[model samples]
Target chain A: MAPTPLAVSIAATIASLVLLFGVLELVRRRRLREKYALLWILTAVVLLILSVWRGAVSGIATALGVSYGPTVLFAVGALFILVVLLHYSTVISALTDRTVVLAQKVASLEQRIDELERGQDSES
Target chain B: MAKRCLAIIPAFNEAGAVGDVIRAIQRERPDVDVAVIDDGSRDATAKVAREAGAIVLQLPFNLGIGGAVQTGYKYAWDNGYDIAIQVDADGQHPPSEMSKVIDPVASGEADMVIGTRFREEGGFKSSAVRRIGIAMFAWLVSTIIREKVTDTTSGFRAVNRKGIALFESDYPQDYPEVETQALAHKHGLRLMEVPVQMEERQAGESSIKLWGSFYYVVKVTLALVIGLFRKPIPLPEEGGH
Candidate 1:
């Protein structure tokens, strides 16, 4: 038997709410940066809206001539994940570059201090 | 006014050859201060360099050749050096040929000067495969920038204060020797190359292996292409004094 539209909507709404609350909890605990949590929250809210408004997905799917309504949800979800992953990768790459620069600065500063101390000792 | 020159030698696990390199440079140019960027070497590179009369900047971790060289540039810029030269610490670069690379920069004729091995008759010839790769890069860079470039991968280079300011802040992190030429040209800095003698490494292996060479070619080529489209980095005000 095909699952009723109401049941499908309830399940999706619950899942999206769980994701939204989980992201908030993580942000509050300082485990996830608020900047990144905002993106997760946006994704969850969009998913929640789509699940509540059953006709919205079907309407877009129909407008796009997609036969399956659920397929539209899955496709959009996959795209969001890809975008989030790419964003994180770029952020990580920038952080890695900055870390290398910081390490170099620290090393040079330490060497300078050593030279200064040595000069002082020799002079005394 | 005479420019204060600093020679920066970036070394990694090169204890055996770095000391000799430092000593040779001091002998060749007594007036020029020498500093060795010891890139997290487990060996006695720092001790050897210091004993040989080089101020050593020992990085806490290995940041590769580019990071190491940038540290030298930063030191030069911060300490009010008028000229900065990069010489590898593996003994491949001949300190006796330092004048050949430094003269153009010191004279204000060029902002940056590179020491080329191919145009010269006396330098140690590279392997055939490496030579081919170098030739290809030379051709590509010259064609793209419309400037004749004979040796794009030479690490021996001298830069004036303006060049120092540019490189100190925005040097490429890996395989920078070639791509930096494009970068220099992009920033409207004058570039020149002089023939200089080079030698085979006296001790220790090259950082790049045979397999690594292939990757190096691809990575540098891509970097050069992307670099063409990048917004030109603005020169620092007052050339970082």
Candidate 2:
């Protein structure tokens, strides 16, 4: 609140750097899609800025009339998580619908091919 | 030109009853082509259906009833069948009573025909819980579609070419019976209900359970409400392949 501790500031900076690198590494490996990676990268950059500017959290919290500064960070983080999870849910629902359609199409085509092969066998 | 009819029986591990259902259709509607979509049944449902003189489209894995039924619609669309009749593989929908459902769709009176059990005085009616569930759906779907659909859960239905194209493109994944009517309405497809006799499952127990019924109602209600908000799919060009 009064002044940030050196150890805590150092820890936060390291953590933000680690987060940023982790996201970049995932993107490099093609593990995380660019669409989602962009979100994580933005989050990492914001954390990096907040960690470097010692007064930013407390200053923002005070402007918003919050007594506890870190609590505000946690609340905002939780809200972000909720929104991201909902996004995932919508994406998953779409994927599920497409998967079902693809399965149905594959089955129909397989049946047709089987029928055609049977007809060829009979004709020959 | 005579309208080519294809009977679609979506079966899942109903090997014991599927044969009888297929045989009945073949015997009664000899002119109608029967295509059984065996939804990855653990039993020999595909083989049995084929042996019974039905064309079996075997899925590599289980895709629930909705996906299985949609596959049948895809076949109807791909093969250009004029009418597609949905007959359950459990033998509940008697192939002899098939006309009551098929006639409306075949005659151009309705784009889709739902064979309702509530219309008749006697048949293998569902339990109290299922009746309540069905009644709730009947009220909700009828209000949404502005049509009296007595049996919202009846699988014994028939769809014309328009209905086939709609379902082949989009269908709900689970418990699709009730929501499909709303979808049909949104797509501007005319629906009709005809009285039909349904038999008890010839071999296995009913697939529905108490908890499953609760889930079914909640999920379908959500689907219907969401359906109201979503834009309706434009019906494909009439008589267009």
RMSD of each: 10.5, 10.6
Error of 2 at A112 (Å): 12
lDDT of 2 by residue, B147-188 (tens): 777888889889999899999888776777887899888988
Predictions in order: lDDT: 0.86, 0.82
DockQ category of candidate 1: incorrect
Best by lDDT: 1
In order, what DockQ does each candidate have?
Answer: 0.04, 0.05
Q: Where does candidate 1 stray beyond 4 Å?
A: A1-124, B239-241
Model 1 chain A worst lDDT window (10 residues): A27-36
The TM-score that candidate 1 achieves is 0.69
TM-scores of all predicted structures: 0.69, 0.70
